[model samples]
Target: DRSARLPPYGKKRLKTCSFTFRNALLNIKEELQKAISTMTARATHSADVAANTSKNVAEKLDLALAIDKRISKLASQAIDYSSQLSGFDSGLATQMASFQEQMSQIKRELKEGLGRLEHVTANAESAGWYFNDCTC
Candidate 1:
């Protein structure tokens, strides 16, 4: 009777081990899939942020260019008026002075904006490096 029971005991042990192994493998698979999903989502978010940042940079550059054009036109006008006036055109001179002040303000704002953009770009690059380091 003992000999007959031995076979059944060994078979039961084998079944338990196989079941445990299968469960372990399934758990590992699920964990891997979850990790992959999380990474994909993070990558997508990063790409979106990069794209939006690029768009914002383009817009800012356009604005800066427009400001430059306006400043150039105003300077040309001021130069022409100055040459035409011999101690004259006080009103035009005052207007040109105001325009010059406004242009200076715009230049300051553009510089600040470019500085901010550079800071943001640097941060993004650092973040990318961090992500790569973490992944490795």
Candidate 2:
């Protein structure tokens, strides 16, 4: 009587096991999709960062080169200015020496003229005394 009352159990158990397997597969697929999406986003972000960094480094190098060129030009200009100033100093010194020589010559001439004037005065005085003695 018990055996006749017992219901079949194999089909119902198989159905339940198949449903659990399907749910497990679905969950694994969702996790894989999420992982793929995350990896792709990270790759894109990393590429962008690398590109921007390269561009910035290139720009900075260019700026540094420009600054170096400017400094070299300025240094050359300073050297030229120093050379010109040195030439001017030498020329000025030569001119001052010439002026000093001319001044010395002028002083000598003045002294000669003074001596001549004194000699002329002595001659005039002698002539006046001779004229007075003859008139008296």
Best by TM-score: 2
- Across residues 1-136, which tens digit of lDDT does each residue of candidate 2 receive? 5434546675666667789889899999999999999998999999999999999999999999999999999999999999999999999999999999999999999889888888888887898788878866
TM-score of 1: 0.55
What would the TM-scores of all predictions be? 0.55, 0.62
Off by over 4 Å in 1: 1-6, 86-136
Q: What local lDDT score does residue 29 receive in model 2, on the 0 to 100 scale? A: 93
* Candidate 2 RMSD to the real structure: 5.7
For candidate 1, write residues 7-107 as lDDT tens digits: 87877887798899999999999999999999999999999999999999999999999999999999999988877784567768888999999999999
Ten-residue stretch with the least lDDT total in model 2:
1-10
The number of the candidate with the highest lDDT is 1
